[model samples]
Target: MYLRKMLFILLTFVSAVSLAACSDDENTTAATPTAKANVKVVHASQDAPGVDLLVDNTVAGTNLTFPNNTGYLQVNAGTRNVKVNVSGTSTTVIQANLNLMENKFYSVFAVNQASAIEPLVLEDNLTNPASGKAHVRFIHLSPNAPTVNITLTDGTIVFGNVAFKGSVDFTPLDAGTYNLQVRDAATNSTVVLEHS
Candidate 1:
């Protein structure tokens, strides 16, 4: 009888332990889900002052200066629109689709997409702007130059430089509308040869 009682006690203890373990598992909570990825974008171009940088119809910044007519964009892993304009020429309009990703960087360059050719070289008064303004194609031909700088009438200055030539060509500005002061940091000279 005593042996039977001891066996019953052992079985009871095992069952209780199992029940407790099961209860603990049922009471425990699960972990939380992970968050989505973050994104960012940047834009710069030759027509820094004249070009408008837009992402998804949102105006990021405008009238800014850049070299290589290039820029950057950060967005979700999806499609985006990058529009370019030189103002008046028949080629004032240029556009591209940007593929963005979470926590990633995007590089964009304004070049012709039709035949793998370079972007149009914007020259004010040469073809006349659609806005009826003369423009400037601030070009930095010296790729070996350390930096290319631009100064506006308002005392605002912008700087950039490319290590290679044939990289980018085009800056659109209103002729006789704005004052532009450009210089090459390497040669300590101006890049925009002719200013109107």
Candidate 2:
């Protein structure tokens, strides 16, 4: 009788230990890390009011006016629902389904005018520039602006023949301040915009 009781208790303890080990394995599998991506938002709509950026109905940016931008935010890799709404309101002015890949970076630009607002999604290349250099790119966000050449004040064209809503790849430049001008591409002499 004593031997049988000892044997029963040993079997029960062994069964409980086995179950606990199996549970730990299941928990480890469920805790696998999720793939992720990085994204940034740029408010470039020329005529739209200050806006908010939403990802899957969650506000990612708020009260972003023209030419403002939000820093990169990490998100799960997959198709994400992106939306832009007027500041302080739930009225969605633009929405898009964006496919984001793991370990990549993206930029979402809210562009055009209030009457024709849209999203311009661009993949960002984050390759490091060479020493003493920086990366530069040109994006034409003016809704009604003409095809233009981006140039230095000295008339050296940095980006040529960029039309409205056009964009250019990143170029390496020596780290320094630059005086830039947007000139008509046809004539390349009429400065429509200037920046330093």
Each prediction's whole-model lDDT (CA): 0.37, 0.75
Score every model by TM-score. 0.31, 0.79
Stretches of model 1 off by over 4 angstroms after superposition: 1-49, 68-73, 86-92, 111-196
RMSD of every prediction: 29.2, 21.9
Model 2 regions lying over 4 Å from their true place: 1-30, 192-196
Give the per-residue Cα lDDT of candidate 2 at 137: 74
State in Å the error of residue 181, model 1.
26
The 10-residue segment with the lowest total lDDT in model 2 = 5-14
Q: Which tens-of-lDDT digit does each residue in 1-196 have in candidate 2?
A: 1111100000000111233333343534456689999998887775679998898999888999877778889988999998899999999999999999998989888877789988888887777777777777777777666687878888888888987778887777776677677777887765454443
**TM-score of candidate 1 to 2 decimals:** 0.31
Could you tell me which 10 consecutive residues in candidate 1 have the lowest summed lDDT?
A: 5-14
Kindly give the number of clashing pairs for every candidate: 13, 0
